[model samples]
Target: MQNSKLLILSSVWVEPKSSAAGGRMLQLIKFFQSIGYSIVYASTASESEFAFDLNALGIESHVVQLNDSSFDGFVSEVQPNIVLFDRFMLEEQFGWRVVQNCPDAIRILDTEDLHCLRNARKGAYKKGVLFQNEMLFTDVAKREIASIFRCDLTLMISEFEMALLENLFKVDRGLLYYLPILIENETIGKFDRRLSFSQRKDFVFIGNFLHEPNWNCVQILKNEIWPELRKCLPDANMLIYGAYPSQKILQLHNPKERFFIKGRAESAEDVIENARVLLAPIRFGAGIKGKLLEAMVYGTPTVTTAIGAEAMYGNLPWNGFIADDNQAFVASAVVLYSEEEVWKNVQQNGFEMVKERFAEHSYLYDLQTKIGYLNANLKSHRQQNFIGMLLQHHTMQSTHYMSKWIEEKNKK
Candidate 1:
């Protein structure tokens, strides 16, 4: 059979080197391509200097407009076999149009992480309270869950989030697909290319500064974690690396105190491989962190909080010690940095976790099987998902008219 066409509506162009979401988007695109899908990526956001060159990868790119009729014409022309929304927001904007224009196309929502979960945790953190499920019932949750119900399948990045949707929100399992960040089988052999524990030096933290969690983490490191850690390991240096560091982030640099803020790593993996240990005192975030995953890939051990290591390891020990307590977190970092045996063991553990939890081949096969099965029995599947049908029907009428109203107003 000839391959089907896949269309992705993104909030921003993929920038793999700049952010974790970008990396995940690129991975998803490449996976579809590898499975013989003709891919086209469309977004409303302007292209940035750091955005990945989708055209260079032989994928067609289009700049779409929100609340416009032009998108209807584009969707009608493309008539994709599958439509994947990058996040719930995009799904909310264009999902109705897709349903109206190409009703047969299998609509999928890729929830990069549970935005509601992350937002709830962040809110609770700011309030100095524990995050509760009740906190998740926000306006964001309403829109995100509605998007999930409207789509044939929603890709979940974390197993934790999948369970939350099933048990807490009571979303059907068939509607949600658990597909974590996958590591290729070939990466297992690349461990040989990594620098040995002794060759690596200093503690490092890398993330996109634009992300609130990362910015909060850097503050926590500066105010709460680093002072204690520096006092303990006076000779040890902490280097912060990330893209688009704001002035506030840059101001944290103090060469006299052995804390250097190195903005924007040229190659995250290269810098990670050279680091003795990765320190991420992430206070609040969702999804698997790309930095933590990169550390494992580069054979670098890490010392992070329970929140930092959440849902990352399944039935296996962490690549390094996980401690939420600042003092203990500092102590773990000291040990991981000083002891070669401990660091080496943790590094090996990381490789094992990557192999077992994130093996690319297993996930690829699972995705292919799921897509093939859905394609063959989409009608029956849709019949079983009456709620999705209802939501789509209602969304079509409500969102459709509102979008058209805005489109008409823009012409005046």
Candidate 2:
């Protein structure tokens, strides 16, 4: 029998070393490959220097243009059995083309995180008010939720967001699938080989700086968290690492204050493994944190806020500590860094979290089974999702004309 074809419409080329979303995309590619799918990855975004080479993995890579009917012919020729959108925005942009060209293709949207939820929280944080579900009713929410309703299945990274969608947004439970940041079993096994507390030094914070939440976390560390933290542990250094550090982020580096902004690590695993403690006091964001999971893989304990640890551990004890207040966060960091026994225990918790929650073996089979069932009953599935059908019909019509108009305008 011929292997099935899967076409992925990505907003950006995969850059696993640069961002968690990139890593998640890579994981999804591997999962589909393991299920005997011949994959074709196409993106409208230009390739970055750090982008992973999908062709190296035997996956076909194509550069696709937005608002162009050329994509219709391209997708029709590929005729993928499954068409996965990297994020909701991609679905909104290219979904209609895919639908008009290949109606039988099972469309899947990977909601890397709930952008609506994250944006709502960011807006609330900016206003110095606690985030409420009512805050979620934004223009972005309308577009994102509509994108969700237009797809056959949407992969949700956080269980909290999944419940929020079902309860707050009134989305059907059948449309959402829970798939967290998956770690390879072999990677989990390397936890024992990570540096011990005595061998490691300094406090580390790593993320992609282009992300607002990460940039905000860095500011919190500099102004609110680090001054107090440095006084508590004067000898230890605070190292910040991330990709695309703007001038403002670079200016935050002060060797005199022991707060150094080291832009982008060569290897996330290497730096994370060497650090005694990873600190991320994320005030607002959605989705499971990739850096925190990387910490678990490297046996590096962390001190993060409740938002950073949300839906990550389930009922399992966190790898280190979750503190919302600056004082409490500093206190946890000092104790975790100072006590070897406590650090070791927390490190063990990380290993356990990896083995139990994120190991690919636990989720991959279920994902495959779900995909198989959806493929077999695609027509009935679409029939049952009335909202999805309605949104697909109406939204795609509007989006289709808008795209064609843009394409014509561009020609002039």
Most accurate candidate by lDDT: 2
| lDDT for each residue of candidate 2 in 1-412, tens digit (9 for 90 to 100) | 0489999998789999999999999999998898899999999988789899888999999999999999988999999999999888899988988889999999999998999999999999999999898999999999999999999999999999999999989999899999998988887777667888888999999999999999999999999988998898889999999999999999999999999999988899888888899999999999999999999888899999999999999899999999998999999999998999999998999899889999999998999999999988999999999988888889777888899899999999
> Where does the lowest 10-residue lDDT sum fall in candidate 1?
180-189
Error of 2 at 123 (Å): 0.3
List residue ranges in candidate 1 displaced over 4 A.
none
Residue pairs in candidate 1 whose N, alpha carbon or C atoms collide under 3 angstroms: none
Clashing pairs in 2: none
lDDT of 1 by residue, 1-412 (tens): 1578999998888988988888888889888888889999999998789988888889999999999999989999999999999999999999999988999999999998999999999999999999788999999998899999999999998988888899998899999888888777777779877899879898999999999999998898888888888888887899999999999999999998888899999899888899999999988888888899889998999988877888899899999999988889989999999999999899999999998888887688889899998889999999998988898899988998999999999999
Task: Quantify all predictions' global Cα lDDT against the true fold.
Answer: 0.90, 0.92
Badly placed stretches (over 4 Å) of model 2 are: none
